[model samples]
Target: MATLPVEYLRTTRLFREKIGDVEIISFEVPVHKYFSRNEIPYLATALDVDFRKMENLITDMKYGRVAVEKLWAYRMDADIIRENKKVLLPDLASNPVDGEVDEFEDAKVLKIHVGPLKEYVRVFVRPRQGFREVVVYRKPPHPAFVRYVAYL
Candidate 1:
């Protein structure tokens, strides 16, 4: 099986503010686009929100708004876009489905559903391989929901 170029992995951060008192931070690392392989990590250190509270809140909020002061800070500094565009764009553009599925013996296409959203993400991976084709189709929640979810 052929290996997907390393440039496929990508990350993004989401932030929110509350009544000038507290701020919330969340980060997402897309494993295969629709289905986030990992939960968003807490980026704010001073927030009083607890883990349980935040977990419950994630279901309600997807991408709140506190102003995306920086969308891809680390990537920008690394010039990842320009460096990997040649290999990345074609792979992302080729697959349009959404969701995850089991690996097969031949080149197989699968879709993975993400969260509570009624959307599907498509992925194409090499048969019986660990890592190959992966991409994310982000459909963030409403602005207000994002703000509330950030607290989670």
Candidate 2:
């Protein structure tokens, strides 16, 4: 929807736990750049998420709507990702911790049940084409994806 390229959309704002809006610690990099097993370390450091967990999430997190504070259909171009970040970054920074994880196994959508959020921040990464949307959200990953949260 916007004209600016998704340069800042280094990571989709799919997470709210570690870094809300990926809380964007300035380590955000291109989505494609984070796929390789070797690249996992850099991606983990940059995003501030656990490297081992991220690797697992990346491998298993495909074709699902990761709802954190909201639901997002992964994959976007430069323009949309840019716009969403610009609008949502501020609110994400201020999001309170009063949230709940809503699990729906049948539908395959895991959501963070935070009530009454002001504004919205959603990143759009361009699909490489011929690939299903995988691990749409980076942080605050699905409960099942993380044994830590699943057991709790």
Candidate 3:
């Protein structure tokens, strides 16, 4: 329906002139990515990735993660995770249950699953419509973390 904001369009155009758009935009693992600094080690262990080597990759911030509007358009499936020996806190096990109205107020609950090992994640688009974020209920073993080592 609506394209990006005017300011974004302007800055993004300037950014394009400065540096061309890329198929994948990447950045080092944010030091403050998790709520607390203490949670990094455990997350590294669970994802089977080095804490220092982790990173966040989005298709492109300007056009968003994908050509599609939906935020969850790009995903790493269980098979991919398992093959890489990258662990998922909330695996198919843990008796994960979808979220109800109370958990995520106002915003549409895309997917929220909870388990005993604090294994679950709630990936949802905010009520503001264009906002997007990933929420991991458990911090120590971040449920929505993965390490992607690729030549591309």
Candidate 4:
């Protein structure tokens, strides 16, 4: 885990999206920061996905050309952490914990049917620790409590 810069904590914008009973909150970190030695403390490993392919998948979903499925499981894959990094975005990436929704106790799973490719990242959203909410957004879900929810 990387320690976020104090400035990022203060200046980074946290975006919130509400999907049904879910509230998805997220923020973007400048991708360039990944290379900065000074910002290393605040960075987590970026998702190494085929950016163009994933982008196309997202576009297809937006146009109703692709199928999306919601799967509920007790655990989520560690790779899910990468989705929150927003590595597909041009300038920004996601912090792993940004999607954990630590504010809620109930965690639900959202599985986007990106074929059966084991290499693709899986994203999910659950309520914050105390409230009942689910999050859906342009970005992916954050796996905040990964140790507890991590899939073997």
- What are the candidates' C-alpha RMSDs? 17.6, 13.7, 18.6, 18.6
Local error of candidate 3 at residue 112 (angstroms): 3.8
In what order do the candidates fall by TM-score, top score first?
Answer: 3, 2, 1, 4
Candidate 3 lDDT tens digits, 74-134: 1234354354322233322223344433345654333334433221354332333443333
Worst 10 residues of 2 by lDDT: 143-152
lDDT of each: 0.28, 0.29, 0.29, 0.28
What tens-digit string does per-residue lDDT give for candidate 2 at 61-146?
A: 33232211112322232254454321122222334323322333322222222233321221122222432222323332221111
Task: Give the TM-score (vs. native) of candidate 3.
Answer: 0.25
| TM-scores for candidates 1 onward, in order | 0.23, 0.25, 0.25, 0.21
Candidate 3, position 98, lDDT: 48
Q: How do the residues 103-126 of candidate 1 rate in per-residue lDDT, one tens digit apiece?
A: 567644444433322333333433
Find the 10 residues in a row with the least total lDDT in model 1. Answer: 142-151
Lowest lDDT 10-residue stretch of candidate 4: 143-152
Q: What's model 2's lDDT at 68?
A: 14
lDDT of 4: 0.28
Q: Give the runs in model 1 whose Cα sits over 4 Å from its true position.
A: 1-28, 31-41, 62-70, 84-152
